[model samples]
Target: MSLAELLALVNDLSQSDKLSLFKLLAAQIPDAELQVIFSASEYPVWSPYDATEAANILMQMIEDDKEASTRA
Candidate 1:
């Protein structure tokens, strides 16, 4: 489902239900899987795990962009 629809559904829920729903959602999203997603995306995706190795890659990209912008 889309974010707008999801938000609407969340808002329709009671506070207790909302927390439970959030916990359920959170449980489905594993950190290892999230790390993989962050690493593979073209855009910068932050990760807590060293497994993704995105920090070095993203930082280098950011550095390159900054240098390019300064040169321009």
Candidate 2:
């Protein structure tokens, strides 16, 4: 299923059901990996762009950062 469809299903879940689902998924990852994922820099709230547009925006940001790092 596409991410949008998966997100739609998740949005329809009850609070307890969401927690259960989160636990189920989280259990599959090792503690160390989860810690690294959680510790990564938090992304800003998404702007009102479609998924494709948002992905392009992020790609540009990544490339800009790469260019800046190369200059430094």
Candidate 3:
């Protein structure tokens, strides 16, 4: 059967059966593959909180543009 047909059948399974099937499939994956799929790495996330320097620079640029437009 095609993957779509298999997925459709799997969709009909109960929650417990789905979990069992997932465990069975996950067990067949190699250790390296599993590690890559579930990586243990910290990723940096950017936040605008306490970004005063960047906000000041952006405000200066806007002011400069306004001044230049008035001069033109």
Candidate 4:
């Protein structure tokens, strides 16, 4: 659907439903960017553990955003 249609539907939703939709959308976007602290001749390091940790952090950020939005 178009953005206009989406906004129209969102306008019809109750506050709780709108909040839920906001959470879903927020979870799909990351709130931060990882900076690569690399030295000359060295590449940014990444491991399975780092990937898992990043995912957890992103989820936590999304939850935090949701909570903050609810308070507004």
Q: Pick the candidate with the highest lDDT.
A: 3
Off by over 4 Å in 3: 40-42, 47-72
lDDT of 3 at 27: 90
Candidate 2: where are CA atoms >4 Å away?
38-72
Residue-by-residue lDDT tens digits, candidate 4, 1-72:
999999999999999999999889867765452132232366678676758878998999999999999999
Clashes (candidate 3): 0
Poorest stretch of ten by lDDT in candidate 4 = 31-40
TM-scores of the models, in the order given: 0.40, 0.47, 0.56, 0.42
Looking at model 2, which ten-residue stretch has the lowest summed lDDT?
46-55
lDDT agreement with native, every candidate: 0.88, 0.93, 0.97, 0.82
Better of 1 and 4 by TM-score: 4
| Per-residue lDDT value at 2 in model 3 | 100
Model 4: residues with Cα > 4 Å off, grouped in runs: 33-72
Q: Model 3 reaches what TM-score against the true structure?
A: 0.56
| Cα-based lDDT at residue 40, candidate 1 | 87
Candidate 2 C-alpha error for residue 13, in Å: 0.7
lDDT, candidate 2, 1-72, per-residue tens:
999999999999999999999999989999999889889997799666568977898999999999999999
Evaluate model 3: give its lDDT: 0.97
What ranges in model 1 sit over 4 Å off?
A: 33-72
